[model samples]
Target: MTERRIVSIWLPRLAIENWQRRNADWPEDLPLALATAGTHGQIVHDLNRAAMESGVSKMSRIVDMKTICPALKISDADHIGDTKWLARLALWARRWGPWSTPDGTDGLLIDTSGADHLFGGEPAMLIDIQDRFASAGCSTRLAIAPTRGAAWGLARFGSERAISKTDPLPYVAPLPVAALRLDPQTLLLLRRLGIRTISDLVAVPRLALMRRFGRANLAENPLLRLDQMLGRRPEPMASPEPPPRYLVETRLADPVMDPSDWLPGMIKDLCDQLAAQAQGCRQLRLSIFRVDGVGCDVTARTAAPTREAGHLLRLFDGKLENIDPGFGFDVFRLTAEAVEPLNAAQPGLDGEDTEGLALARLIDRLTARFGADAISRPLSYESHIPERSQILGAPVSDAPAPLARADRPLRLLTPPEEIRVLYAIPEGPPGAFIWRHQTLRVAKHAGPERIAPEWWHDRSGTRLRDYFRIEDPTGLRLWIYREGLIHDGRGAAPRWFLHGIFA
Candidate 1:
C-alpha cells in the first residue's frame, strides 16, 4: 500500500481577511482588530497585519489596543460565521484531493495521498495550493508530509514546506513543543521541567515521562503526539458529509422555444432516483433556464407521498402556460423538495385499497385544478365536547380514528339550540319539549350521562351537564343536554339544549 500524504494549511489571518473581504471600503493601511466579549471586557480575538505591525497582539484588551494604535478600527468578532466560512473553504479545497476537512477554527487539513503526481510533484502541488489561496485574498502556510501531525507542525512552525516521504522525525524534532498541539497547562508544566522542544523531550527516559504524565489523555500527552508525528500512530482523515440533494438537470444541445418535451424525461429520471432510494416526494419544483439569463419555476404538490411518473406529470398540467420563454431555454431541472420513506407492499388478492388510491388521486387533481387551501377533510380531535372534537385540515393528512363510543350522534350542531321543557318529572328526563316553536312528545329515553367541564379552561360560572338520548313519537331521536342543575347557584333555572341528531 502507498504511504498516506497529508497536507495541513494554516490561515493565521483568516478572521481579519474575511472581514476585509466583506467590507472592501475600509482603508487597508489602518490597523484593525476583531474583539470578543471576555471576562474583563472586549478582548482582541484576531487582528490584521497593520494591527500586528503596530505592536497590538492577540488577547490584548481592546481599550489598551486603542492606546497603542490610536487609529485602530475595532469590530465585534463573528466567531460562528468564521467557522462556517472555514468549513465551506475546506470543502472548496477538495479539488486537489479526495477529501478535506477543517482543522481548528482557522485551518484546513487535506489528505492528498497519491494525488500529487496529477499536479506535477509534491512541491508543485503545494505551490499551486498557495497560489490559489493567495488569489482568493487569503494568506496561507502549507506543508505536506507522510503524517498529519508532522505536516501540521511544519505548516505552522517549520521553514520547509515539504518533508521527506521516508521519514519526518528529523524535520519535526526541531519544532517547539507547542507544535505537538498540547494544552497550555501541559506546556507550562513541561517548561518548568526544563523541556523546551521536541528533541529535549525525546531525550528524557520514556518510563520517567510516562510516570509523570500518564497515557490516559491522547490530546494532552506529549508521547502520543510524538508517536503520531513520527508515523508510529495512525491518524485518519475525516471529512464532513454534505447534505443529501435530490435534483436532476438536462442541458439541451440547442436552445428551444418550448421545454414541454424535456420535462417528462427529467421528471422520470428524478422519480427513478427516488425509487432507487426507497423514497417518495410530496413536493417538486421544475425550473427552466433561458439562454437570455432568465429562469422561471413552477411547483407541484401531491395529495400524498408518491413517485409515480404519470401521477406527477398530470399535476403540472396547464402550469407552464404563463412562462414567456423569451429568447429560448437551454436547460431544464427538477428537484424534490419534500421526501418521505415509502417501502413496497404486496397487493391484496381482492385489490382492496384501489378505492383509497383513487380517492387520493381525485384529491390531488382537484387541488391542482383549484388551490392547496380549497381541498380539506375533517380530522378528529381529543375533546369531550361534541362541537370541539373535529377540525378541518389537509385532505391527505392522517384519517381520524373511529370514535370510542358507539352512541355518538351522526352529526352535531355548531351551536346547540335552546329548548323549553313543557312538562317533566322532578330531577328526571322531560316528558315533552318545545323546540323551534314545535312541541315534541317523548316516548323512550336512554341516559343522563353527566359530563364535567374542563376545569383548566372553563370560567367560574361554568357548570356540569347531563346528556340524554330522547326518541319522539315520530321515531326522531335527538341528543339533549341540561346545562345546569336546579338551585345550583350558577344560573337561574336549568336549561335544555338540542345538541345533535341521530342518523
Candidate 2:
C-alpha cells in the first residue's frame, strides 16, 4: 500500500479569539480577549495575535493584562459555546477528508489523501480552509505532509514554502527543535550543545544522542530517525468530529416570550427532531438556546440503543420547564452524543412490553423538571458504614451494572451527627441513645459489624468504626456507629454517631 499523507492544522490563541469575537458581534479590528473570572479576578486565558504582539499572553493576570492592553475588550470564556461551534466546524470540515480531529483548543487535522481533488488539489484545499476560517475571522495555519509530526512542525513553525507536500523537508529543516515537541529540559540541553534546528539533531548519531540524554529523554523527544521521520510507522489521528451521531436544530422565526405559550410546543418539536435523528442511536443530548444568549443542556441515555420518538420525548418531559426560554428561545438543538452498534435483535412476537418503557419515561420527565440530578435511585456500595454504603444515582437509569450488595440501610443522614447514649454496652450495642435533643431507649440491637478504616485514603487519620442497627421503643430503626476500638488503645473512648434512620 502507498504511504498515506496527513494534513495538520493549527489555530493559535490569537486566531481563535479573533474568530470568536467576529462571530459574536465584536469589533473585528480592536484587540479582543477571552478570559475566566475567579477569586483573584479576571485572568486572560486566550488572546488573538494582535493582543499577543501587544504583550498579552495566556494565563496573564488580569491586572497585568490590563496594563498591557488598556483598551482590551474582555469576554468571559464560554467553553460550551466554543465546543458547539467546534463541533459544527468539524462537521463542515468532514467534506474535505474522511478523517478530522481537533488540534488542541484551536486547531484541526484532516487526512487529505483521497479527498484533496474536490477542493481543487492540496494547495487549493489548504487555501480554501484558511479562507473559510479567515472569513469567519479565524487565523489558521495549514500544513500537509507524509507524517503528522512533519505536518505539525510545518504548520506552526514552518514558513509558507514548507507547506507543500513536495520538498517539505527543506522548509521543515530550518525550524527549531521545539517543533519536534521536545520537552523544555531536552530542548535546553540540545540548544546548549549547538543543536538549534531539526536538521542539526538529525545529523547526530541516534545511539550517542540516547546515551547522553538517557532513554527516558526519548519520551516526548520529537527527533525522528530517517525512516520514522518519513512516516513509515503508524501514526493515529484523534478525530475532532463530535463522535459519529446526528443532531437536530430548530430555529424559531420569532423568539417566544411566554413560557406557557412556547414551552410545550418547543419541547415537542425538539423531541420529534431528536427521535428522527436518532434512528439507530441510543444516547441523546438536548441543548436549548434562549433569546438572552444563555443555554441549557441535558442528556438522556437508555439501557439499549433506541430511536423511538415517544420513548425519547417522554424522557425529556420532566426537564422542559427548566428550559426557561429566557426572553423566549430562538433556537433549540438536539444531538446524539453517543451511539452503540445495533445488531437489530428481532423484537418479541407480542411487542407489548411497555411497563419498563413507561417507567423510564416517567423518570425522564421527573428528571427534566427537577434537573437530572434531582431524582435518583438508591444504589448500595460495599461498606458497613450506612452513609458510605448507599448512593443516589440518576433516576432515568437503573443502578450500576453488577449491582453492589443491597444490605445497607434504606435511609442515610445528609451528614452523620454525633449522638449521646444514656445506656450503652462497652463491648456491644447501646441500650439507649440521645439524638437531635431527643432521648430514646433501645429495645433491641444487632450488629457490631466492624468496618476498618481505609488507611490508604484516611486523610482525617481517624480509626476504624463499629456500626450497629438499633430499634427504639416506637419500632423506629436507627443506624449508629462508634469510632475506634478500646483494644487498639490509640485514642480516647469511642465516640458515638447517628448515621441514618430506616423508614
Candidate 3:
C-alpha cells in the first residue's frame, strides 16, 4: 500500500487580499492595507505585504505607514468578516478531501490518501487547488508530505520548489529556523548556536540534541524529526469535513410568504431526503433558509443511529412548526450531523411495539407543532410539595417511560389562592375555606408534606414552605402552600397561596 500523505497549504498574505477581494469596490491596483488603531489612537498591525515592504511593519503608527507608502489605502481589519470567509473557505475545501483541518491563522490541511485519485493524483490536485484559490484572488503555497511538520515547513519555506511529491527534506533544509514555527526565544537560541537551517539541526545526534534541549523543548519545536519525516511517527490529522452522512435540502421555485403553507411539505421533504441519505447516520439537522438569506436551524437526534425515513420524518414533525419560514423560505436543508454503524435486530416474538417509540414520535410532532415546551413528560424532583416534587421536561425520544401517577382531581391553582379559613389546624390542612370568592368546604384532604427550604439558598431570605393537597366539596383538587414556620421570628403570620389544580 502506498504511504498516505497529508497535504498542508499556507496562504501567508491571505487576510489582506481576502479583505480586498471581498470588497470588490476597493481599487485593486492601489497598494491596499489593513490596520487597527492602537491604544495611543493610531493605526497598528499593518496587514499588507506592500505596506510591510515599504517599512510599515505590524504595530507601526498610521503616520509612519502613510509616510512610507504615500499612496497606500488603509482600512481597519474586519476580524468578523475574516472569520466568516474563513469558514466558507473551510467548507469549500471539504470538497477535496474526507478530512480538511485549518492550520494556524491562514492555512489548511487536506487528507489526500483516498481523495487524491479523484483529482487525478497529487500534482493535479495541487494544481486544481491552486487554480481555484488563484481564481478567488488569493495566493497560496501548497506542500504535501508524510508529516504535518514537514508539509508546513515546505509550504512556508520551500516557496521556490516544484509542486510535486518529491523528497520534502531537500526543500525544507534551506529554510531558516523561524520556518519551524519555533518560539522567538528558541529561534534566537538556534541562531546563537549557528543552527541557521533545518539541515544544520538534522545533522545533530537525536539523543545529544534531546539532552541539550529537554523533552519539553523538543515538544515545542515544530520541525518534524527524521523519524516523522520518514513516516515513522504518525501525524495527527484534524478532520476538516464533518463526516460522510445524509443531507436533505429544498429550494423553492418561488419565495414563500407564509410559513404555514410551506413548512409541512418542506419538513416532510427534508426528512425524507435525509432518511434516504442517512443509510447509517445518527443525528440530523433541519435547516431553513428564508428568501432574504437568513437561516433557521434545529436538530433531531435519535437514541441510536438510524436511517429510517419514516422515523426521521416523524421526529421532525415535532419541531416543524417552530420554523417561521420567514417572509418566504427559498431553501430547506436537512443534514445528518452524526452517524454510527447500523446493527440489525429481530423483533420480539410477542410482536408488540411496546417501546412507545411511536408515542415519542407523536409527542415530538405535537411539540413541533405547538412549541418545544408545549408538550412535556412529568418528572419527579426530590421535594415533598406536590408542585415542587413534579416538574415538566421537554419531550425526548429516549427517556424511560413514566409510571402513571395516582388519580387526582383536575384544576390546580397557580400560586394556590389564599382564603379565609372557617376551620384550621396549627399543623394540618384547613377543613373549610373561602377561596376564589367562594367558600369551599374541604370534604377530604392529604396531610402536610413539610418541605424545608434549602438553607444554602438562604441568601434570598425567604422562609420555608409546608404544602398539602386539598380536595374541596365540589371535587376540586388544589395544591396550596403555607409560607413560614410557626417559630421562625420572621413575623408576618403564615400566608397560604394556591399554586395549581390537578387534572
Model 2 has how many clashing residue pairs? 11
Measured by TM-score, how close is model 3 to the native structure?
A: 0.61
Candidate 3 regions off by >4 Å? 36-64, 78-88, 134-137, 159-178, 184-197, 204-216, 219-235, 238-282, 286-298, 301-358, 366-376, 393-402, 409-503
lDDT of 2 by residue, 9-51 (tens): 7766543554565467655567767788756877876876667
Ranking by lDDT: 1, 2, 3
lDDT of 1 by residue, 355-421 (tens): 6567777887888878777777777777777777787754543443345456868688879999999
Please estimate how well model 2 matches the true structure, expressed as its whole-model Cα lDDT: 0.66
How does model 1 score by TM-score? 0.55
Q: Which ten residues in a row have the lowest lDDT in candidate 2?
A: 258-267
Which one is best on lDDT?
1
Candidate 1 regions with alpha-carbon error over 4 angstroms = 1-9, 35-45, 50-103, 108-137, 142-151, 158-176, 184-205, 215-220, 228-270, 281-305, 308-341, 344-415, 419-503
Per-residue lDDT over 1-503 for candidate 3, one digit per residue giving the tens place of the 0 to 100 score = 76667777787676787776667686545666677768776674436555566666766777777888798777888767766666556555655665777787688887777677877877888887787677566788888876777787777777632343536667667777676767778778778888898788888777766666655454455334544554556667867546645544455667775434444555465445544544455567766655432456677666445555566666655455556655666555567677655544455688744365446556555655665545556665765444565576645544444454564334445545676777777688777777768887777778576677666645456777777788877787877777887678776778777666777
- Every candidate's lDDT: 0.83, 0.66, 0.65
Compare candidates 2 and 3 on TM-score and give the better one: 3
Task: Please provide TM-scores, in order, for all candidate models, with all chains considered together.
Answer: 0.55, 0.47, 0.61
